[model samples]
Target: MLTIGTKAPLFAAESTKGRIDLQTLIGKKKLVLIFYPGDETPICTKQLCAIRDRYSDLEAADAVVIGINPADLTSHQAFSGKFGYDFPLIADEDQAIRKAYKVGKILGFLFQQRIVYVIDKQGTIVYAKKGNPPVTELLQVVNQNP
Candidate 1:
Protein backbone atom coordinates (compact mmCIF):
# COMPACT_ATOMS: atom_id res chain seq x y z
CA MET A 1 0.00 0.00 0.00
CA LEU A 2 1.08 3.59 -0.58
CA THR A 3 2.60 5.01 2.60
CA ILE A 4 1.87 8.24 4.33
CA GLY A 5 3.26 11.47 2.80
CA THR A 6 3.08 10.09 -0.71
CA LYS A 7 1.39 12.25 -3.32
CA ALA A 8 -2.22 11.02 -3.50
CA PRO A 9 -2.81 9.52 -6.88
CA LEU A 10 -5.26 11.71 -8.73
CA PHE A 11 -8.38 10.30 -10.35
CA ALA A 12 -11.85 11.36 -11.46
CA ALA A 13 -14.34 8.53 -11.08
CA GLU A 14 -18.05 7.95 -10.58
CA SER A 15 -19.38 8.69 -7.11
CA THR A 16 -22.80 8.41 -5.53
CA LYS A 17 -22.99 12.21 -5.40
CA GLY A 18 -22.24 12.19 -9.16
CA ARG A 19 -18.92 12.50 -10.98
CA ILE A 20 -16.30 13.43 -8.40
CA ASP A 21 -12.83 14.59 -9.31
CA LEU A 22 -10.36 14.23 -6.49
CA GLN A 23 -9.04 17.72 -6.98
CA THR A 24 -12.49 19.19 -7.25
CA LEU A 25 -13.72 17.43 -4.14
CA ILE A 26 -10.79 18.48 -1.98
CA GLY A 27 -11.54 22.15 -2.45
CA LYS A 28 -10.39 24.21 0.58
CA LYS A 29 -10.41 21.23 2.94
CA LYS A 30 -8.73 17.99 3.70
CA LEU A 31 -10.22 14.72 2.49
CA VAL A 32 -10.52 11.29 4.00
CA LEU A 33 -10.70 8.52 1.41
CA ILE A 34 -12.07 5.52 3.26
CA PHE A 35 -11.69 2.29 1.33
CA TYR A 36 -13.77 -0.77 2.03
CA PRO A 37 -13.72 -4.13 0.28
CA GLY A 38 -17.28 -4.14 -1.05
CA ASP A 39 -20.58 -2.49 -0.34
CA GLU A 40 -23.55 -3.61 1.83
CA THR A 41 -21.55 -6.12 3.77
CA PRO A 42 -21.87 -6.06 7.56
CA ILE A 43 -18.59 -4.40 8.50
CA CYS A 44 -18.65 -2.11 5.51
CA THR A 45 -22.17 -1.00 6.30
CA LYS A 46 -21.32 -0.39 9.93
CA GLN A 47 -18.20 1.57 9.04
CA LEU A 48 -19.96 3.70 6.43
CA CYS A 49 -22.89 4.39 8.72
CA ALA A 50 -20.56 5.30 11.55
CA ILE A 51 -19.09 7.95 9.32
CA ARG A 52 -22.49 9.02 8.08
CA ASP A 53 -23.81 9.35 11.59
CA ARG A 54 -21.02 11.73 12.45
CA TYR A 55 -20.81 13.50 9.13
CA SER A 56 -21.66 16.84 10.66
CA ASP A 57 -18.66 16.52 12.92
CA LEU A 58 -16.47 15.70 9.93
CA GLU A 59 -17.72 18.78 8.11
CA ALA A 60 -17.26 20.93 11.15
CA ALA A 61 -13.66 19.86 11.25
CA ASP A 62 -13.28 21.10 7.68
CA ALA A 63 -12.71 17.63 6.36
CA VAL A 64 -14.45 15.64 3.63
CA VAL A 65 -15.27 11.94 3.64
CA ILE A 66 -15.33 9.78 0.52
CA GLY A 67 -15.67 6.03 0.32
CA ILE A 68 -14.26 3.86 -2.47
CA ASN A 69 -15.24 0.45 -3.71
CA PRO A 70 -15.23 -1.60 -6.91
CA ALA A 71 -19.01 -1.44 -7.18
CA ASP A 72 -20.60 0.57 -10.02
CA LEU A 73 -22.75 3.68 -9.62
CA THR A 74 -26.00 1.81 -9.53
CA SER A 75 -24.85 -0.22 -6.59
CA HIS A 76 -23.28 2.82 -5.03
CA GLN A 77 -26.47 4.89 -5.27
CA ALA A 78 -28.57 2.15 -3.81
CA PHE A 79 -26.14 1.61 -0.98
CA SER A 80 -25.75 5.31 -0.30
CA GLY A 81 -29.44 6.10 -0.34
CA LYS A 82 -30.43 2.97 1.51
CA PHE A 83 -28.21 3.99 4.38
CA GLY A 84 -28.42 7.74 3.98
CA TYR A 85 -24.68 7.96 3.62
CA ASP A 86 -23.69 11.59 3.85
CA PHE A 87 -20.47 11.35 1.90
CA PRO A 88 -19.80 10.24 -1.63
CA LEU A 89 -19.19 6.54 -2.15
CA ILE A 90 -17.02 6.48 -5.23
CA ALA A 91 -17.16 3.78 -7.86
CA ASP A 92 -13.72 2.38 -8.46
CA GLU A 93 -15.05 -0.30 -10.79
CA ASP A 94 -11.88 -0.82 -12.81
CA GLN A 95 -9.75 -0.72 -9.64
CA ALA A 96 -7.60 1.96 -11.19
CA ILE A 97 -7.81 4.23 -8.20
CA ARG A 98 -7.29 1.40 -5.74
CA LYS A 99 -4.21 0.28 -7.66
CA ALA A 100 -2.96 3.83 -7.81
CA TYR A 101 -3.27 4.04 -4.05
CA LYS A 102 -2.03 0.46 -3.61
CA VAL A 103 -5.14 -0.28 -1.57
CA GLY A 104 -6.32 -3.41 -3.32
CA LYS A 105 -7.07 -6.54 -1.34
CA ILE A 106 -5.15 -9.79 -1.20
CA LEU A 107 -6.68 -13.07 -2.35
CA GLY A 108 -7.99 -13.97 1.12
CA PHE A 109 -9.14 -10.50 2.10
CA LEU A 110 -12.62 -10.04 3.46
CA PHE A 111 -13.09 -6.41 2.37
CA GLN A 112 -10.34 -4.34 0.82
CA GLN A 113 -8.65 -4.62 4.20
CA ARG A 114 -10.58 -1.57 5.41
CA ILE A 115 -8.21 1.38 5.12
CA VAL A 116 -8.37 5.11 5.48
CA TYR A 117 -6.19 7.90 4.19
CA VAL A 118 -6.28 11.42 5.52
CA ILE A 119 -5.10 13.80 2.82
CA ASP A 120 -4.21 17.36 3.56
CA LYS A 121 -5.37 20.44 1.75
CA GLN A 122 -2.46 20.10 -0.66
CA GLY A 123 -3.52 16.54 -1.37
CA THR A 124 -0.62 15.07 0.53
CA ILE A 125 -1.39 12.15 2.79
CA VAL A 126 -0.79 12.85 6.45
CA TYR A 127 -2.37 9.87 8.10
CA ALA A 128 -2.97 6.32 6.89
CA LYS A 129 -4.24 3.38 8.89
CA LYS A 130 -6.20 0.18 8.69
CA GLY A 131 -9.86 -0.77 9.34
CA ASN A 132 -11.14 2.78 9.67
CA PRO A 133 -9.69 2.68 13.20
CA PRO A 134 -11.77 5.40 14.83
CA VAL A 135 -13.36 8.64 13.74
CA THR A 136 -11.86 10.20 16.85
CA GLU A 137 -8.39 9.43 15.57
CA LEU A 138 -9.40 10.85 12.22
CA LEU A 139 -10.88 13.89 13.85
CA GLN A 140 -7.66 14.43 15.78
CA VAL A 141 -5.69 14.21 12.57
CA VAL A 142 -8.04 16.65 10.90
CA ASN A 143 -8.07 18.95 13.90
CA GLN A 144 -4.30 18.97 14.21
CA ASN A 145 -3.60 19.47 10.47
CA PRO A 146 -5.11 17.83 7.46
Candidate 2:
Protein backbone atom coordinates (compact mmCIF):
# COMPACT_ATOMS: atom_id res chain seq x y z
CA MET A 1 0.00 0.00 0.00
CA LEU A 2 1.19 3.57 -0.74
CA THR A 3 1.87 5.61 2.34
CA ILE A 4 0.82 9.16 3.02
CA GLY A 5 3.35 11.98 2.42
CA THR A 6 4.87 10.18 -0.55
CA LYS A 7 4.89 11.54 -4.08
CA ALA A 8 2.17 10.02 -6.20
CA PRO A 9 3.32 8.02 -9.19
CA LEU A 10 2.41 9.89 -12.35
CA PHE A 11 0.88 8.23 -15.37
CA ALA A 12 -0.85 8.98 -18.62
CA ALA A 13 -3.82 6.85 -19.56
CA GLU A 14 -7.08 6.83 -21.44
CA SER A 15 -10.20 7.83 -19.58
CA THR A 16 -13.81 8.43 -20.46
CA LYS A 17 -12.91 12.02 -21.16
CA GLY A 18 -9.66 11.37 -23.02
CA ARG A 19 -6.02 10.82 -22.13
CA ILE A 20 -5.37 12.03 -18.57
CA ASP A 21 -1.86 12.98 -17.56
CA LEU A 22 -1.42 12.82 -13.80
CA GLN A 23 1.61 15.12 -13.85
CA THR A 24 -0.40 17.95 -15.34
CA LEU A 25 -3.22 17.40 -12.85
CA ILE A 26 -0.85 17.49 -9.87
CA GLY A 27 -0.44 21.23 -9.54
CA LYS A 28 -3.96 22.08 -10.68
CA LYS A 29 -6.16 20.65 -7.95
CA LYS A 30 -6.49 18.06 -5.27
CA LEU A 31 -6.87 14.65 -6.87
CA VAL A 32 -8.90 11.68 -5.75
CA LEU A 33 -7.89 8.44 -7.42
CA ILE A 34 -10.33 5.60 -6.80
CA PHE A 35 -9.21 2.08 -7.61
CA TYR A 36 -11.93 -0.50 -7.69
CA PRO A 37 -12.11 -4.18 -8.51
CA GLY A 38 -14.34 -4.12 -11.53
CA ASP A 39 -17.32 -2.49 -13.20
CA GLU A 40 -21.02 -3.45 -12.81
CA THR A 41 -20.48 -5.45 -9.62
CA PRO A 42 -22.95 -4.62 -6.87
CA ILE A 43 -20.50 -3.01 -4.45
CA CYS A 44 -18.56 -1.31 -7.20
CA THR A 45 -21.74 0.19 -8.59
CA LYS A 46 -22.77 1.53 -5.22
CA GLN A 47 -19.34 2.95 -4.56
CA LEU A 48 -19.16 4.74 -7.91
CA CYS A 49 -22.73 6.01 -7.64
CA ALA A 50 -21.99 7.54 -4.29
CA ILE A 51 -19.09 9.44 -5.79
CA ARG A 52 -21.19 10.42 -8.79
CA ASP A 53 -24.01 11.71 -6.64
CA ARG A 54 -21.68 13.83 -4.52
CA TYR A 55 -19.51 15.03 -7.39
CA SER A 56 -20.56 18.60 -6.94
CA ASP A 57 -19.20 18.64 -3.42
CA LEU A 58 -15.90 17.37 -4.72
CA GLU A 59 -15.77 20.10 -7.31
CA ALA A 60 -16.64 22.70 -4.72
CA ALA A 61 -13.51 21.71 -2.85
CA ASP A 62 -11.40 21.96 -6.01
CA ALA A 63 -10.91 18.24 -6.16
CA VAL A 64 -10.86 16.06 -9.26
CA VAL A 65 -12.11 12.52 -8.92
CA ILE A 66 -10.88 9.82 -11.28
CA GLY A 67 -11.83 6.17 -11.03
CA ILE A 68 -9.45 3.46 -12.23
CA ASN A 69 -10.32 -0.13 -13.06
CA PRO A 70 -8.86 -3.02 -15.00
CA ALA A 71 -11.86 -3.27 -17.26
CA ASP A 72 -11.59 -2.19 -20.88
CA LEU A 73 -12.81 1.06 -22.39
CA THR A 74 -16.08 -0.44 -23.61
CA SER A 75 -17.03 -1.66 -20.14
CA HIS A 76 -16.00 1.64 -18.57
CA GLN A 77 -18.07 3.53 -21.11
CA ALA A 78 -21.15 1.47 -20.43
CA PHE A 79 -20.77 1.64 -16.68
CA SER A 80 -20.22 5.39 -16.56
CA GLY A 81 -23.10 5.96 -18.98
CA LYS A 82 -25.48 3.84 -16.93
CA PHE A 83 -24.64 5.71 -13.74
CA GLY A 84 -24.58 9.15 -15.37
CA TYR A 85 -21.13 9.83 -13.98
CA ASP A 86 -19.54 13.02 -15.23
CA PHE A 87 -16.04 12.32 -13.96
CA PRO A 88 -13.45 10.31 -15.81
CA LEU A 89 -13.26 6.56 -15.41
CA ILE A 90 -9.80 5.38 -16.40
CA ALA A 91 -9.28 1.97 -17.97
CA ASP A 92 -6.20 0.25 -16.58
CA GLU A 93 -6.45 -2.58 -19.05
CA ASP A 94 -2.89 -3.88 -18.54
CA GLN A 95 -2.98 -3.34 -14.76
CA ALA A 96 0.30 -1.40 -14.82
CA ILE A 97 -1.18 1.56 -13.04
CA ARG A 98 -2.85 -0.68 -10.47
CA LYS A 99 0.42 -2.41 -9.67
CA ALA A 100 2.28 0.91 -9.51
CA TYR A 101 -0.27 2.21 -7.06
CA LYS A 102 0.08 -0.95 -5.03
CA VAL A 103 -3.62 -1.77 -5.25
CA GLY A 104 -3.00 -5.37 -6.12
CA LYS A 105 -5.42 -8.30 -6.23
CA ILE A 106 -7.25 -9.12 -3.03
CA LEU A 107 -6.50 -12.31 -1.13
CA GLY A 108 -5.36 -14.13 -4.27
CA PHE A 109 -8.56 -13.15 -6.00
CA LEU A 110 -8.66 -11.85 -9.53
CA PHE A 111 -9.75 -8.32 -8.72
CA GLN A 112 -7.95 -5.46 -7.04
CA GLN A 113 -8.99 -4.13 -3.66
CA ARG A 114 -11.08 -1.01 -3.31
CA ILE A 115 -8.56 1.71 -2.55
CA VAL A 116 -8.65 5.50 -2.51
CA TYR A 117 -5.74 7.91 -2.70
CA VAL A 118 -6.16 11.61 -1.98
CA ILE A 119 -3.35 13.74 -3.35
CA ASP A 120 -2.75 17.39 -2.67
CA LYS A 121 -1.81 20.07 -5.17
CA GLN A 122 1.91 19.41 -4.68
CA GLY A 123 1.41 15.76 -5.60
CA THR A 124 1.82 14.53 -2.06
CA ILE A 125 -0.50 11.79 -0.98
CA VAL A 126 -2.44 13.10 1.98
CA TYR A 127 -4.89 10.26 2.49
CA ALA A 128 -4.68 6.63 1.58
CA LYS A 129 -7.30 4.18 2.76
CA LYS A 130 -9.14 1.06 1.81
CA GLY A 131 -12.87 0.53 1.16
CA ASN A 132 -15.37 3.28 0.52
CA PRO A 133 -14.52 6.38 2.46
CA PRO A 134 -17.31 8.88 3.03
CA VAL A 135 -17.57 11.73 0.59
CA THR A 136 -17.55 14.22 3.42
CA GLU A 137 -14.30 12.83 4.74
CA LEU A 138 -12.73 13.06 1.32
CA LEU A 139 -13.83 16.64 0.96
CA GLN A 140 -12.46 17.43 4.38
CA VAL A 141 -9.12 16.01 3.41
CA VAL A 142 -8.97 18.09 0.27
CA ASN A 143 -10.03 21.27 2.01
CA GLN A 144 -7.59 20.77 4.85
CA ASN A 145 -4.67 20.15 2.55
CA PRO A 146 -5.43 23.21 0.50
Candidate 3:
Protein backbone atom coordinates (compact mmCIF):
# COMPACT_ATOMS: atom_id res chain seq x y z
CA MET A 1 0.00 0.00 0.00
CA LEU A 2 1.16 3.55 -0.69
CA THR A 3 1.90 5.71 2.31
CA ILE A 4 0.90 9.27 3.05
CA GLY A 5 3.37 11.87 1.74
CA THR A 6 4.88 9.57 -0.88
CA LYS A 7 4.07 10.54 -4.45
CA ALA A 8 1.42 8.44 -6.10
CA PRO A 9 2.47 6.35 -9.05
CA LEU A 10 1.47 7.65 -12.47
CA PHE A 11 -0.99 5.74 -14.59
CA ALA A 12 -2.63 5.97 -17.99
CA ALA A 13 -5.55 3.58 -17.89
CA GLU A 14 -8.48 2.48 -20.03
CA SER A 15 -11.76 4.02 -18.98
CA THR A 16 -15.31 3.63 -20.23
CA LYS A 17 -15.13 7.00 -21.96
CA GLY A 18 -11.51 6.67 -23.12
CA ARG A 19 -7.95 6.39 -21.98
CA ILE A 20 -7.49 8.56 -18.92
CA ASP A 21 -4.27 9.79 -17.43
CA LEU A 22 -4.51 9.91 -13.66
CA GLN A 23 -3.04 13.36 -13.43
CA THR A 24 -5.44 14.64 -16.06
CA LEU A 25 -8.51 13.28 -14.32
CA ILE A 26 -7.40 14.65 -10.98
CA GLY A 27 -6.31 17.96 -12.53
CA LYS A 28 -6.31 20.44 -9.66
CA LYS A 29 -8.65 18.45 -7.47
CA LYS A 30 -7.98 15.97 -4.75
CA LEU A 31 -7.96 12.43 -6.15
CA VAL A 32 -9.65 9.63 -4.28
CA LEU A 33 -8.76 6.35 -5.95
CA ILE A 34 -11.01 3.47 -4.98
CA PHE A 35 -9.61 0.07 -5.89
CA TYR A 36 -12.20 -2.62 -5.94
CA PRO A 37 -12.10 -6.39 -6.26
CA GLY A 38 -14.24 -6.66 -9.40
CA ASP A 39 -17.34 -5.30 -11.07
CA GLU A 40 -20.93 -6.26 -10.30
CA THR A 41 -20.02 -8.07 -7.12
CA PRO A 42 -22.30 -7.43 -4.16
CA ILE A 43 -20.06 -5.33 -1.98
CA CYS A 44 -18.44 -3.58 -4.89
CA THR A 45 -21.82 -2.65 -6.28
CA LYS A 46 -23.02 -1.23 -2.99
CA GLN A 47 -19.85 0.72 -2.39
CA LEU A 48 -19.83 2.13 -5.89
CA CYS A 49 -23.47 3.05 -5.79
CA ALA A 50 -22.90 4.78 -2.48
CA ILE A 51 -20.17 6.75 -4.06
CA ARG A 52 -22.32 7.41 -7.11
CA ASP A 53 -25.03 8.84 -4.95
CA ARG A 54 -22.50 11.16 -3.36
CA TYR A 55 -20.88 12.45 -6.51
CA SER A 56 -22.02 15.99 -5.95
CA ASP A 57 -20.66 15.95 -2.42
CA LEU A 58 -17.31 14.75 -3.65
CA GLU A 59 -17.25 17.38 -6.34
CA ALA A 60 -18.08 19.98 -3.75
CA ALA A 61 -15.03 18.88 -1.81
CA ASP A 62 -13.03 19.43 -4.98
CA ALA A 63 -12.35 15.74 -5.36
CA VAL A 64 -13.05 13.30 -8.11
CA VAL A 65 -13.66 9.71 -7.03
CA ILE A 66 -12.31 7.26 -9.57
CA GLY A 67 -12.93 3.55 -9.16
CA ILE A 68 -10.18 1.25 -10.39
CA ASN A 69 -10.81 -2.38 -11.21
CA PRO A 70 -9.29 -5.15 -13.25
CA ALA A 71 -12.44 -5.46 -15.30
CA ASP A 72 -12.45 -4.53 -18.98
CA LEU A 73 -13.81 -1.30 -20.38
CA THR A 74 -16.93 -2.90 -21.80
CA SER A 75 -17.99 -4.25 -18.43
CA HIS A 76 -17.08 -0.99 -16.77
CA GLN A 77 -19.24 0.94 -19.22
CA ALA A 78 -22.21 -1.33 -18.70
CA PHE A 79 -21.81 -1.20 -14.96
CA SER A 80 -21.53 2.57 -14.90
CA GLY A 81 -24.48 3.06 -17.24
CA LYS A 82 -26.58 0.53 -15.39
CA PHE A 83 -26.07 2.34 -12.13
CA GLY A 84 -25.91 5.85 -13.63
CA TYR A 85 -22.57 6.38 -11.99
CA ASP A 86 -21.49 10.00 -12.29
CA PHE A 87 -17.84 9.36 -11.59
CA PRO A 88 -15.42 7.62 -13.92
CA LEU A 89 -14.69 3.90 -13.64
CA ILE A 90 -11.15 3.19 -14.61
CA ALA A 91 -10.42 -0.08 -16.45
CA ASP A 92 -7.24 -1.51 -15.14
CA GLU A 93 -7.68 -4.62 -17.24
CA ASP A 94 -4.02 -5.52 -17.25
CA GLN A 95 -3.66 -4.79 -13.55
CA ALA A 96 -0.88 -2.32 -14.21
CA ILE A 97 -2.39 0.38 -12.13
CA ARG A 98 -3.23 -2.07 -9.39
CA LYS A 99 0.39 -3.11 -9.08
CA ALA A 100 1.53 0.48 -9.19
CA TYR A 101 -0.86 1.32 -6.40
CA LYS A 102 0.18 -1.82 -4.49
CA VAL A 103 -3.29 -3.33 -4.57
CA GLY A 104 -2.19 -6.89 -4.07
CA LYS A 105 -4.24 -9.81 -5.35
CA ILE A 106 -4.91 -13.39 -4.44
CA LEU A 107 -2.61 -15.90 -6.06
CA GLY A 108 -5.09 -17.54 -8.44
CA PHE A 109 -8.03 -15.22 -8.39
CA LEU A 110 -8.52 -12.22 -10.60
CA PHE A 111 -9.93 -10.10 -7.82
CA GLN A 112 -7.94 -7.34 -6.20
CA GLN A 113 -7.88 -6.34 -2.57
CA ARG A 114 -10.16 -3.44 -1.73
CA ILE A 115 -8.33 -0.24 -0.93
CA VAL A 116 -8.73 3.50 -1.30
CA TYR A 117 -6.05 6.10 -1.79
CA VAL A 118 -6.80 9.73 -1.10
CA ILE A 119 -4.24 11.83 -2.88
CA ASP A 120 -3.66 15.52 -2.55
CA LYS A 121 -3.29 17.93 -5.45
CA GLN A 122 0.46 17.51 -5.55
CA GLY A 123 -0.02 13.72 -5.98
CA THR A 124 1.07 12.52 -2.56
CA ILE A 125 -1.20 9.91 -1.05
CA VAL A 126 -2.52 11.72 1.99
CA TYR A 127 -4.69 8.89 3.20
CA ALA A 128 -4.90 5.17 2.51
CA LYS A 129 -7.31 2.43 3.49
CA LYS A 130 -5.68 -0.96 3.09
CA GLY A 131 -8.62 -3.30 3.52
CA ASN A 132 -12.38 -3.24 3.56
CA PRO A 133 -12.77 -0.12 5.63
CA PRO A 134 -16.07 0.77 7.20
CA VAL A 135 -18.07 2.38 4.43
CA THR A 136 -19.58 5.04 6.62
CA GLU A 137 -16.27 6.22 7.97
CA LEU A 138 -14.65 6.20 4.55
CA LEU A 139 -17.53 8.10 3.10
CA GLN A 140 -17.36 10.55 5.93
CA VAL A 141 -13.70 11.25 5.32
CA VAL A 142 -14.27 11.60 1.61
CA ASN A 143 -17.31 13.74 2.16
CA GLN A 144 -15.79 15.85 4.88
CA ASN A 145 -12.33 16.22 3.39
CA PRO A 146 -13.07 16.15 -0.27
Candidate 4:
Protein backbone atom coordinates (compact mmCIF):
# COMPACT_ATOMS: atom_id res chain seq x y z
CA MET A 1 0.00 0.00 0.00
CA LEU A 2 1.01 3.63 -0.52
CA THR A 3 2.57 5.20 2.52
CA ILE A 4 1.92 8.47 4.25
CA GLY A 5 3.88 11.54 3.06
CA THR A 6 4.34 10.14 -0.43
CA LYS A 7 3.04 11.91 -3.50
CA ALA A 8 -0.13 10.28 -4.71
CA PRO A 9 0.00 8.47 -8.03
CA LEU A 10 -1.84 10.33 -10.79
CA PHE A 11 -4.33 8.77 -13.14
CA ALA A 12 -7.35 9.45 -15.35
CA ALA A 13 -10.17 6.94 -15.42
CA GLU A 14 -13.87 6.65 -16.09
CA SER A 15 -16.16 7.04 -13.12
CA THR A 16 -19.81 7.20 -12.35
CA LYS A 17 -19.54 10.98 -12.37
CA GLY A 18 -17.60 11.06 -15.65
CA ARG A 19 -13.88 11.03 -16.28
CA ILE A 20 -11.69 11.78 -13.27
CA ASP A 21 -8.16 13.05 -13.52
CA LEU A 22 -6.09 13.07 -10.36
CA GLN A 23 -3.89 15.85 -11.78
CA THR A 24 -6.87 18.19 -12.10
CA LEU A 25 -8.01 17.60 -8.53
CA ILE A 26 -4.57 17.63 -6.93
CA GLY A 27 -4.21 21.27 -6.05
CA LYS A 28 -7.92 21.99 -5.67
CA LYS A 29 -9.30 19.63 -3.05
CA LYS A 30 -8.38 17.10 -0.40
CA LEU A 31 -9.08 13.53 -1.49
CA VAL A 32 -10.34 10.44 0.29
CA LEU A 33 -9.65 7.36 -1.76
CA ILE A 34 -11.49 4.31 -0.47
CA PHE A 35 -10.22 1.17 -2.12
CA TYR A 36 -12.61 -1.67 -1.53
CA PRO A 37 -12.83 -5.28 -2.62
CA GLY A 38 -16.13 -5.34 -4.43
CA ASP A 39 -19.23 -3.27 -5.07
CA GLU A 40 -22.37 -3.81 -2.99
CA THR A 41 -20.75 -6.49 -0.86
CA PRO A 42 -21.73 -6.27 2.80
CA ILE A 43 -18.52 -4.88 4.19
CA CYS A 44 -17.81 -2.66 1.22
CA THR A 45 -21.33 -1.21 1.25
CA LYS A 46 -21.18 -0.53 4.95
CA GLN A 47 -17.78 1.05 4.66
CA LEU A 48 -18.81 3.44 1.89
CA CYS A 49 -22.25 4.12 3.37
CA ALA A 50 -20.61 5.41 6.50
CA ILE A 51 -18.94 8.04 4.35
CA ARG A 52 -22.21 8.67 2.52
CA ASP A 53 -23.97 9.28 5.80
CA ARG A 54 -21.54 12.01 6.70
CA TYR A 55 -20.67 13.14 3.21
CA SER A 56 -21.58 16.74 3.83
CA ASP A 57 -18.90 17.01 6.47
CA LEU A 58 -16.31 15.85 4.00
CA GLU A 59 -17.65 18.24 1.39
CA ALA A 60 -17.51 21.09 3.88
CA ALA A 61 -13.87 20.23 4.47
CA ASP A 62 -13.14 20.64 0.74
CA ALA A 63 -12.56 16.92 0.26
CA VAL A 64 -13.75 14.65 -2.49
CA VAL A 65 -14.44 11.00 -1.65
CA ILE A 66 -13.71 8.52 -4.42
CA GLY A 67 -14.29 4.77 -4.35
CA ILE A 68 -12.00 2.53 -6.38
CA ASN A 69 -12.19 -1.15 -7.16
CA PRO A 70 -11.72 -3.54 -10.02
CA ALA A 71 -15.41 -3.53 -10.81
CA ASP A 72 -16.48 -2.22 -14.20
CA LEU A 73 -18.38 1.03 -14.72
CA THR A 74 -21.70 -0.75 -15.03
CA SER A 75 -21.30 -2.41 -11.66
CA HIS A 76 -20.25 0.85 -10.07
CA GLN A 77 -23.21 2.70 -11.56
CA ALA A 78 -25.70 0.15 -10.30
CA PHE A 79 -24.23 0.18 -6.83
CA SER A 80 -24.05 3.98 -6.66
CA GLY A 81 -27.55 4.41 -7.97
CA LYS A 82 -28.94 1.99 -5.42
CA PHE A 83 -27.16 3.68 -2.55
CA GLY A 84 -27.58 7.26 -3.76
CA TYR A 85 -23.85 7.89 -3.40
CA ASP A 86 -22.91 11.42 -4.42
CA PHE A 87 -19.24 10.80 -5.04
CA PRO A 88 -17.55 9.20 -8.02
CA LEU A 89 -16.79 5.49 -8.04
CA ILE A 90 -13.89 4.83 -10.36
CA ALA A 91 -14.12 1.85 -12.65
CA ASP A 92 -10.69 0.43 -12.25
CA GLU A 93 -11.50 -2.68 -14.20
CA ASP A 94 -7.93 -2.92 -15.38
CA GLN A 95 -6.62 -2.59 -11.81
CA ALA A 96 -4.02 -0.13 -13.03
CA ILE A 97 -4.85 2.30 -10.28
CA ARG A 98 -4.79 -0.51 -7.75
CA LYS A 99 -1.39 -1.58 -8.95
CA ALA A 100 -0.18 2.01 -8.83
CA TYR A 101 -1.25 2.30 -5.23
CA LYS A 102 0.33 -1.03 -4.34
CA VAL A 103 -2.94 -2.45 -3.07
CA GLY A 104 -2.61 -6.18 -2.64
CA LYS A 105 -5.09 -8.93 -3.28
CA ILE A 106 -6.70 -11.39 -0.92
CA LEU A 107 -8.72 -14.61 -1.28
CA GLY A 108 -6.09 -15.86 -3.65
CA PHE A 109 -6.19 -12.73 -5.78
CA LEU A 110 -9.94 -12.67 -6.02
CA PHE A 111 -10.36 -9.43 -4.07
CA GLN A 112 -8.34 -6.38 -3.29
CA GLN A 113 -7.79 -5.54 0.33
CA ARG A 114 -9.84 -2.73 1.83
CA ILE A 115 -7.81 0.39 2.32
CA VAL A 116 -8.37 4.10 2.80
CA TYR A 117 -6.09 6.96 1.91
CA VAL A 118 -6.50 10.65 2.74
CA ILE A 119 -4.59 12.99 0.48
CA ASP A 120 -4.06 16.66 1.15
CA LYS A 121 -4.53 19.35 -1.47
CA GLN A 122 -0.90 19.21 -2.53
CA GLY A 123 -1.44 15.55 -3.46
CA THR A 124 0.49 14.05 -0.58
CA ILE A 125 -1.05 11.10 1.14
CA VAL A 126 -1.55 11.97 4.80
CA TYR A 127 -3.28 8.86 6.05
CA ALA A 128 -2.99 5.26 4.97
CA LYS A 129 -4.56 2.34 6.76
CA LYS A 130 -6.34 -0.93 6.32
CA GLY A 131 -9.94 -1.87 7.15
CA ASN A 132 -12.87 0.49 7.86
CA PRO A 133 -11.74 3.37 9.98
CA PRO A 134 -14.29 5.66 11.53
CA VAL A 135 -15.39 8.70 9.57
CA THR A 136 -14.78 10.89 12.59
CA GLU A 137 -11.12 9.95 12.60
CA LEU A 138 -10.89 10.72 8.91
CA LEU A 139 -12.57 14.09 9.48
CA GLN A 140 -10.06 14.93 12.20
CA VAL A 141 -7.16 14.23 9.87
CA VAL A 142 -8.62 16.17 6.97
CA ASN A 143 -9.60 19.09 9.17
CA GLN A 144 -6.26 19.08 10.97
CA ASN A 145 -4.11 19.02 7.83
CA PRO A 146 -5.29 22.22 6.11
Best-matching candidate per lDDT: 4
User: What would the per-residue lDDT of candidate 2 be over residues 1-146, giving only the tens digit for each residue?
Assistant: 79999999999999999999998998998999999998999999998899898999999999999999999999999999999999999999999999899997886778999999999999999999999988888988988998
Tens digits of per-residue lDDT, candidate 3, 26-102, equal 55778878999888889889988887776787787788778999888889999999999888899887788999988
Tens digits of per-residue lDDT for model 1 on 69-132?
8888999999999999989999888888888888868557644667899998888899988775
lDDT for model 1 comes to: 0.85
Give lDDT: candidate 1, residue 81: 92
Once fitted onto the true fold, the runs of candidate 4 whose alpha carbons sit more than 4 angstroms away are none
Model 4 lDDT per residue over 2-58, tens place: 999999999999999999999999999999999999998999999889999999999
Candidate 2: stretches off by over 4 Å: none
Q: What is the number of residue pairs that collide in model 1?
A: 2
The stretch of ten residues in a row with the least summed lDDT in candidate 4 is: 137-146
Q: Report the candidate with higher lDDT, 1 versus 4.
A: 4
Local accuracy by lDDT, each model: 0.85, 0.93, 0.80, 0.96
- Candidate 3 structure, TM-score to reference: 0.88
TM-score of 2: 0.97
My TM-score estimates for the predictions, one after another, are: 0.93, 0.97, 0.88, 0.99
lDDT of candidate 1 at residue 50, scale 0 to 100:
86
Could you tell me the lDDT of residue 65 within candidate 2?
Answer: 97
